[model samples]
Target: MVKNPLKIFMLINCLGMYDWSLSAKYFLNIYVFASTIQNSGSQRHMHFIKKTLNMEIFGCFALTEVSHGSNTKAIRTTAQYDPTTQEFIINSPDFEASKFWIGNMGKNATHAVVYAQLYTQGGQCHGLHSFVVQIRDPKTLLPMPGVMVGDIGRKLGQNGLDNGFTMFHNVRIPRENLLNRTGDVTPEGVYSTSFKDVRQRFGASLGTLSTGRVSIIGMSVVNLKLALSIAIRFSATRRQFGPNDDEEIPVLEYQMQQWRLIPYLAATYVLDHFSKTLFMDLVELQLGLLQNDKSIRQAELGREIHVLASAGKPLASWTAQQGAQECREACGGHGYLAMNRLGDIRNDNDPNCTYEGDNNVLLQQTSNYLLNCITDRHQDKVRIESPLESVNFLEDFKDILGQKFMISRVEDCMDSSVSLAAYKWLVCYLLRESFQKLNQERKSGSDDFEARNNCQLYKNLWATVLQGSKVLERPSWWREFSSYKPTVGSLKSKL
Candidate 1:
């Protein structure tokens, strides 16, 4: 195993991992079913219906591989067809190509919805895709033939998961295993999928990625809240440097400490509002997608929400990580102890920057989506509408950046309004820079791969811009704050 067992146990304890396990099972069996019955049914049900449906549990989502952590196109595992038995012959081909870093994968999971390259006619397959594979006995929890599984071992945090790696030496699963909602395969060795463009098909796999990003953003907000509350309360009580030239004063009084804590406090408020707004918007998008087959609005919303989530998570997580560090430093020595919770908070939030898409790689997705809109308007004469309007700053980019947004009536530095102005300008600045870099790449004859990699740098730049804009423009979260809305009774009275 790659992870240290002891540290894993401790981290798991800190995170209430057992509680998550119970909650997951409960939701999978009950709430998730109740919610999805009218829809497509629990994804778990869709993946595993005939194979010991009640007793078995699955731990799979084709995300990370030993060699290709974020780049799905590089994954080397293959699920090729076996004509005689009508099964897919699964093979790792090599160690670096082996499946790794999957949660609940060690010995806890009996089944996995494996991701592999689909091959039919011996021609090279184009992209990564998902398939159902039974790896162990649901009752026994042991590896099956031509299969190997074990833990990845110690990390900074997140230990409850039996994150493990597996190698398939010609392991086999049925040919009917392909999850065909987006793509499919025929028994006579044929490939079929709705997506004509390979890139679009690749993108189809990431539809749920936005949901994960949104949840992580929400998690980052709560984590910030927890750390802030602890530090703020402690600072109010803990006394340090001085008052009337004699007695010690509460640490909260120190301007330096307040400076460190207050921005985080303000940030937590901003992120809280941002998360709530994104969630509501996501709900509407989800509902529309479920109700209608082709939802242009929802697709746009998904792209927008994903961009927001990707943008907010890195900002909020990096902020929370820094805030936790500050909180620890502010508390002096006691904060180092696990009991105080700041260190644990830091450890937990650290992964947020790397997982569910590494912050850098994920940022490119945001930039790509934004750039696509910008380029479309310029090249196709396509008049962009909807959420792209949020990016209107792109049109007046030079003017927006050349002058301060709210010059004359600049509010107090601490006021939320001042922060909003800074944030808006940052967004405009980054958007302009991204467009400029994109245009330059096109002009300079850079290859598609190099251009895309170059865009990653702009993504990080935009993140900083997005963070500054959040402080200066509108708080996404504020829309959801109950305090901002009219009372339900007042609305009812109008009715």
Candidate 2:
């Protein structure tokens, strides 16, 4: 390890941005790039150039295009091999298909890890794969031949970072440019991969979803913390109606205000706890993958972890948005200012719901994955470990759902012991609802894409509903709240 003090300080000082989305992206890229290089030789020079020198080389993963953001399989950018030159020719064939909305692509990127459909000899089209293409010379910020890149201009938020649209017209990249960890092709045009199953291939393509989900959870937690800190401090100081004519009371003293804010306080606390625990689960999953465990348990864990993170991110982002708005109202006029940070936080988080994968589209992946598990149970197949084992409601499937709210506290809404009960109701309800809607669309003679689009409305509705239920039943919130209690009793004895 290099014992440079200056680099240590730079790394230490990076956590200053409390809830900013761009800040989180900056941090993630830093950590990921470091891990990528220090731990492996796959992209060492790229990492060194980007981070070690403070050079602003924003190399975004160019997966999503203008025409299709979440739908990766539908992207049209083509990469054709030139056997004579030993290079690949990349192009966006039409207007609707250019790479769009990629961070670091606009003005700062010297290179991009672009994803495109690979067409080889005999015209066999391989699914999406990444290529590290040189966009600009690292020293000179000019575009390379056959590469077109520029910003998408101002966005809803995170405008400090330039996100660009890209078009590739006959761009030639050396044969070695491909990241071939999952799949590879030879000079003779024989394409092969370790994963023969297309579903597994697609899953490998989206393995990064774990990190994306983790970042969203962390970002949402930070946003919630900032909002709650502001609101809590402001609530304690702000005066409102009181029983006596001569006196004023703090906003927090009111039951309604307590109902609105304190529950969220409890919620924010819980989500923080949950995020940390889930991160540990992810760490284990990573270790399992690295160890080449490849047991049925490992695959099951990967799917479950993806489901948890996907389901959890939308929940946190939506909560943060609501919490920020409530915090703004609680702050009266001050929260409206951009400097107060609530509004900006809200705007930045808005894209989280739609990006990475549309929260709705992603939930279906989780539900589909989970429903497959349920089908396995129905078929009397032996099963591997599942996070749902923590929730007994899934086993019974009949007893607790629709079992009356019993009370109206936020705590009641998210009772940990019976939390899975709510989750069952939420999932079964949405699953059935989506099925019914999809069936209706098909019965009415709509095509597959049209039916899927129409079904998306229910998808959004059900995802939110399911997430809300999970929050109440899971122990994440209560555990988080418990940690904040005064531990003076135990500390005194130790002292």
Candidate 3:
């Protein structure tokens, strides 16, 4: 965890280039699960943590349900405390309540940190709680009695790791299995926690969720890097028609190719930088968890991380998704070949846009966070700030809005500052506009849900680079460009 961020991202880039499935497998098996137990599990869970870190035992995280994906509070699985038996009975009330898309559980994992609603004596459900459940035999990998587990067979891509689903039918575990860092149930069925506020308890319990999404941002950048590396190299070397029969030039000489591939190249570097920086901020959040900060600032840090990750994941994943497609198309027939790995890159990147959280849903999450910021700014006079200082700029929204975009010369566009100023203005403008829209929708009798969704279009402005040289020059062409295509009889006939 203390490793250099650059080295880690570089490793992710290299491993993902060879195959994204390996990169995913590495994270799902080693990183997130370890962090989850550390954050949510108690001292009694030390042996499990030690074995996991030593790679002596395998584990997976089972939180997402088949029926309820994002709406975690409404998840249907239950873990009821049996006072006389001194055990908790875990059950999936229906097929829909079964956990789905659990990584590592499909084949290798013997244990899982299963999330389910905790019930005490008299069926008093105390919301969602995590429990350490042994799902398979240590030596034989057989499903434990009362548990029905199976692999979710193939899909779009990243099939190297087996994803799975499982349902529990009165599966029983000792009362000590509950990961009760935030809240715990007594052996006598008494529930107690430091935070009496249910919202605070929920926030503290699920703080680790943001970490997984933060990690996904880096993975997405790696996919973009791999795609850009392959496509840009191909563009630079693959020759096209020349100015004359004796003269030929690479397709990279064309402006269109540069326009298509160079931006993504720049984006990879930018996202790479952001991913590293964001992960460093993640260290602060993890520190608070380990120290049990329990302060308002710690709670603010959690909210900040959630907002950033909710937005950043979509930004990086969608960028990678679009970049991969453009790269595949830019390479023409070569990109389509499976051997080249371009198609693999594209398919692998596609999952990022959906998993962890769907990009569209994430965009709405970001918007809701923004709306809250603006509302506080307007009504409570609370300063727009975050542990990461990401939203701090909004405090001067009035000034930013007042500032005008005034670059007249085309030469000014080459200066990075020019675009940056315009981008800031654009962001401020959108924030202001969306806030008003939400108010307008509410005035027109729309609920918060409807107002938030309606404002998604304007709330999506977030992160982009490049400049001069012999840059935009078309040195030679007829080989790959349109200039020579008309002359070729084979192509001319088609035209």
Candidate 4:
């Protein structure tokens, strides 16, 4: 177990700089499963780690079903406990229930940590549970009996990764194969859990799932940096229209080029710091969990971390998506050339916005968490207790809501502080409006899901904007801006 999880993120960032597709495959297949098993406390499967570290066995995570991506609860795959045989049977009832878009599962993986609905002897379905199931033989590279697996074919990017699919038909494994940290099934087929609340237990079980999303944040920064580096360097070198016929100006000197590329450059610095800080926070939470600290504070911290990841993934990914496209366009015909690598960067990053969790669906989680905080404060159940203080400003909701944008000049708006204040106001306003819409929907006899869906537009926008502003605040780039003036002058000198 790495004491600092951020180190993993940094390593992924470096790998992404070389090849994002390779980094994505490593993240989805190795890093995520490793983190899950470490947190899962499945001692019986610990050898999988040794094999992985020794380069003996490759692994993939299988969660997304053919018909169910974000909706884990709706997955139809079943793992039924058989007390008579002292084993668990894993099965996919239909094609729709087959696992889809599983990285590294098609061609290379020898094992998988599969998520399936658990069933005891009493015919009770106990939500989703993780199971370590052997998918292929290490030496022969063949699928096990009763398992159907194959590659998903080529993709827009990440074609190097064998994104695959799997289906199981009455595949039986030992009862000990279950990842039973939060809940377990005994030989007698009794299902037991430490937490009384199902939701809380689910939360505890998924404490480490954010690792992939956190890494995506850093990978997005890498993508942004790559795109900006190529575009900016090209802009500095490529010459165009000039004031005199005898000389041509560097593209970087054009205000349009600066406007297109500089802000994203600044954002790259901002998101880089934000991603590292978030990774550190994740490390702290994981360390506490590893120490078996089940305190309420730890649980709250986990929840906070989840919300941050849910929002941060989308924020960083969408930024990379837009930045890559912008950079591609800024470099003109040269960026379109395969030699420059901008196209691959753009295509590779597109999936980040949709994977782990769909960006829009993930935003709903953050918004729902925010709504709960506001409700808790209003009902006096608790103060705005954000362990990370990401939402502590909600405590001063009234004041924040009252604030109006006052910056009248472009110069004033350029200051980070002014931008922060304005964004805070916007977040507060959107939060209030979203809350009102949700309440109105509920008052009309809509269920929680309906109410949330009704407010999706505001909730999504609020989370996205709030996360961007938060990241913008994490880096001390103003001083760096002052120091980099000479570099800008040098680019101009090329004219």
TM-score of each: 0.80, 0.80, 0.89, 0.91
lDDT of 4 by residue, 1-495 (tens): 433455667677788898876876777655787778777765676787777767698888898998998887788999999999999999999999999999999798888999999999879988888988999989999999999999989999988889999999999999988988888998999999888899988777666668778888888999999999999999999999899999999999987788778878888898899888988888888878778788988988899889889988988998898899999999999889998999999999999999889998998888888888878777875777578887887788898877765544445545989767766777778888887888899999999888777778877777776767434332454434433233544333331
lDDT digits (tens) for residues 70-148 of candidate 3? 8889999999999998899999999999999998888888889999999998888889989989999978999999999
| Predictions in order: lDDT | 0.65, 0.67, 0.79, 0.83
- RMSD, one per candidate, in order: 9.4, 8.0, 7.1, 5.9
Candidate 4 minimal-lDDT segment of 10 residues: 486-495
Quality of model 4 by C-alpha lDDT: 0.83
Top candidate when judged by lDDT against the true structure: 4
Winner on TM-score between 2 and 3 is 3
List residue ranges in candidate 4 displaced over 4 A.
Answer: 1-4, 404-415, 469-495
Model 1 deviation from native, Cα RMSD in Å: 9.4
What residue pairs clash in candidate 3, if any at all? Answer: 240-479, 240-480, 241-478, 241-479, 241-480, 242-477, 242-478, 242-479
Q: Please provide, for model 1 over 1-495, each residue's C-alpha lDDT reduced to its tens digit, 9 standing for 90 to 100.
A: 112322322343334322333333332222222222213222434435433235455445445789987777788899887766788888999999888877667657666667788887666474677776777776678898998988889776766546678889999887766655556667777777767777766665556566556656766776777788888999999998785768999989987678668878888897878776776676666566456445566556666777777777777767777777888888888778878878877777787788778776666666776678777777887755566356554565456578643333212334876655666666666676778887788689998778767777666666655545334232544322223345545433332
- Residue 63 C-alpha lDDT in model 1: 51
Deviation in Å, model 4, residue 365 alpha carbon? 1.0
Where does candidate 3 stray beyond 4 Å?
1-13, 453-495
Between candidates 1 and 4, the one scoring higher on lDDT is 4
lDDT of 4 at 464: 70
- Candidate 1: where are CA atoms >4 Å away? 1-55, 122-126, 245-247, 287-292, 387-389, 392-406, 409-422, 451-459, 469-495
Cα lDDT of model 2 by residue, 1-495, tens digit = 113423422332235244353564454345433322222223423444344336455456567888887778889999887677777888999867898887677887776667789888878888887777778776777888888888888888877667788899899897777666556778877787877688776665566667567667766777778778878887888898788988999987876566557767888887888776777776676666545555767766777778888888877877877887888887788768878777876787777777677776777776665555555555685342474343324554434344643443434434675555555666665555666677689899999779877776666666666677344333543444334342544323322
